[model samples]
Target: MRKRIVRYLLALLGIGAIGAAVFLFMFIRPLPVEVARPAEAVPVQVFGLGTVEAHILSKIGFEVGAALVELNADHGDRVSQGDVLARLHNGEQQARVARAKAGVVNGEAAVKMAQAAVGKARAVLAQKKLTNERKQALLSRQTVSVESAEESQMEVDVAAAELAVAASDVDVAKAALEDARAQYQLETVLLDHHVLKAPYNAIVVERHKELGSVLAPGEALFTLVAPETVWALAYVDEARAGDIRVGQPAEVRLRSLPRQMFEGHVTRIAIESDRVSEERRVYIACDHCPDRFHLGEQAEVFIRTAALDKALLVPETAVEGFDGTKGVVWTVEDGDLRRREVTFGNRTLDSRLEITGDLPDGAQVVTTLHPGLREGRAAKVTEEAAP
Candidate 1:
């Protein structure tokens, strides 16, 4: 009976050991995996975070200080160049202009009077010359008394002096008139300063001051931005910004309008990079943006630099010891797993690196990592769809 019980226990232990071995064998077996394969028509894109901004923005105000009297434009109002945007309480300036105008009128009259005085002086001088000639002729003939001729000659001399003095007075009056006209022009220019005009065609972004607010010289009253100057300012990482160039096609996704995608192109690239952020500034012009745009709205941009006919791609996380230029990747050759250090290029917007070179002949690069992946292990490879 003891021998029979021991045999039964020993048989049960052997069966348990066999079951454990089978489970371990199944757990450790190499599983099938999807390897990266060259896909037809793969697009390389670079991503950037950006904001809606205008290339030409301005804050305009009055040139002279006064109380705000009239406001013709408000926020979101579109104005043309030379349009009157606002006005200051310029009653004093107007009065000065009016006084200057009256002074100008007076000056015109004074100038005419001076011209008339000159004419009168010329007539007097001519008459005096005739009288002096007649007196000298009488003296030569000895027909008139000596004292009478001398008195007539002295009177002619006195009239000539009076004419010269009148001419001098006319010159002084004309000079004063010119000064008055100059003063009038100065006053007129000062009065015009009370009115503010738009420097260019733009949409009013904000109204800084309300009516009745006293504004100082050069104080901002309206923040204006040209509609045509609107563009997206994207800050791209320097690592991914190398391929970006002007005129490349791009797509924009605004935070406020997440469901919509606006098409655009690379308009400009800043010559100097942002020192602190280590980013390159790239500007994009939206082709089909909405009529209304909020400045500083967050945005995401994807620029298509190149389109590849066939590209082998792998996720960035699958790479090991990637020093930006080259990295180690697992490759499958002859139904076995192997590791290779490969050179990469063109990082896609989806965080995938393109396998450009450095692969063994007949070896397929792995796109996904797995715990069972080991050197010399057999692999059943499956191709994944291009993303």
Candidate 2:
């Protein structure tokens, strides 16, 4: 009786399994899927992570090392080019400059004296020549002794030599004057270096040294930025940077002001890329950024690369084997399921990929991925969105 009961139970279980299989094959054969066709007039954008930066930033200081005697500007101060920002101790440099001025004055006096000497020698030489000529005429007429004429000639020769020496002295004096003037100029330049001046129209961002602090050459006393040169720098993934071009519209959101968006445009694209991170550096010039700015502040950037008239977009999560340019995706063709490889183009900021390749006419691309999808299986659109 137990064996008979066991056989009956086994037969019942077998019938139930057969019924389940039949129901699954007949009713569940066609998979319902949500699909999206090509969309029109979609804006394409690429996302990047970056920071607020400036095109012109500077660390300004004195060229010569000295004690900082005065500070005329501090952080947040606005300065114009050639405005005195600070001053080093000018005592020693000033003394040197004064000494050079005295030397220049002395050199001028020497030059004048040498010129006077030259003129005197020339006058003496003229007189000697006159006397020598008169003696020569007297000797030719036998009115003077030959020895007297010879003596006159010797005197004239001596005067001529004196004139040459005086002329040489004049040259030496002029050269000395030039040297003195050059020395004075050099001293003046060094003295000027003791005073730090603004390089351009800038806003002082930082002050590194206090007054009376001694600093080394090229040591920064203040940080400066050209207010007009403020911009945003973005580091975009190289894979998505192929479509970025100069003058494209972009939007920037500073991390400090997360809720606000700043309008900007692409100003420059670096020819080189970050080697380790494989990112391209792009510069965006802000159109109406605030007067106050913080350098190196974190920011988000969205760059509009293209505007699509009609495009089939699939989320990056839906594509299989996506290599940035091409990927495989599911599609519904003739009410049947299929997997097709398609080429991709510009990516939107929300991480959607644009389909650029030829998809079959009247075929709907599966956007909502579902499990158990098989090729040649009957498919139906669960929900369709209006174009």
Candidate 3:
């Protein structure tokens, strides 16, 4: 009785397996797929990942070293051109400037004294010339001795030498005045350096030093971002970058503002692509950027390269072997799958490829391929449910 029971159970399991096989074969015999249609006025877009950057982002510092004394601007502060941002210990610098001014005043007085000396020397030289002429006349008339006339000539020579010395002294004094003035200008410039000022309208992003902190030349005191120079730096795939051009319209979506969309335009395109990533760098300027922006923020950009009035549309999943501009797709004809070569046009944001070639309207395309599905294999067309 036990042997009979085991044989009965084995026979029932065999019958169930056969029925399951038949059910599966009937339901999954042919590949079922959806159809595609030609579309019109589809906007072609190229996608890229990018960063929010400032065209004039800078790490500003002093050219000369000093100790921090006062900070007029802090992080997030908006400053205008020539606005004081911070100050270094300027007491010493001020003292040097005052000393230079005093030197200039002293130099001016010296110049005046030299001018008076020159005038005195000229008057004395004229007097000596008159005396020498009178003595020579007296000698010719036999009224003066020869030795007296010779002595008069020597006195004239001595007077001329004194005049020359006085003129040289005037020139030397003038030069000293110029030197003092130059020193004054230099000292004033050095004093100005002690005060850190903004070069343009910008927003401060960082503050590195505090009061009494000693800073070195070229050490960054603050980081600034020019509000007018904010832009997006995007890296586009080399394959799709062929159509990208400057002045084209684009859309930007920043990571910080996820739900908001911004308008922009392409400003520049890098000719050289990244060798490792095979991406071209592109710069886009915002049309109406945010009042405030964070540097190096991640972004997504879509550049409108072209617009097509009419194009044959196919789901991106239905196409394979795409090399940016060209790809292949599987089309159905008379209940059999056939390989069709297609040239791709502008891709839509909805993952639809614009077919450029002459493809039939309302043709069935295979979106999901199975291992059993091959070229010339019979397929059943099924309509895709509308989203």
What order do candidates take by lDDT, descending? 2, 1, 3
> Each candidate: what lDDT?
0.88, 0.90, 0.85
Best by TM-score: 2
- After aligning candidate 1 to the native by TM-score, how far in Å is the CA of 12 from where it should be? 15
User: Residue 297: error of model 1 in Å?
Assistant: 1.9
Assess the local accuracy of residue 52 in candidate 3 as a C-alpha lDDT between 0 and 100: 93
How many Å off is the CA of 324 in candidate 2? 3.0
**lDDT tens readout by residue for model 1, 265-367:** 9999999999999999999998887878999999999999999888888899889999888999998889888999999987777888888899888888888
Q: Residues 1-387, candidate 3: write the lDDT tens digits.
A: 999999999999999888888766754467776666556677888898989988898999987799998889888999999999888888888999999999999999999998898899889889988999999999999999999999999988988998898889989999999999999999999988888999889899999888889999889999998888899999998877888999999999999899988999999898788999999999999997876688899999999998888766777777889887777788887888887777877777688787777555555666655565677766788885231
Query: For residues 1-387, could you state the per-residue lDDT of candidate 2 as single tens digits?
Result: 999999999999999999999878765678888787678899988888998888899998889999988899998999999999999988988999999999999999999999999999999999999999999999999999999999999999999999999999999999999999999999999999998889999999999999889999999999999989999999999988998999999999998888998999999999999999999999999987965789999989999999999887888887899987898889899999899998888787777888888677777888877776878889988886443
The TM-scores, one per candidate, come to: 0.77, 0.94, 0.81
The numbered model that scores best in lDDT is 2
Candidate 3 or 2, higher TM-score: 2
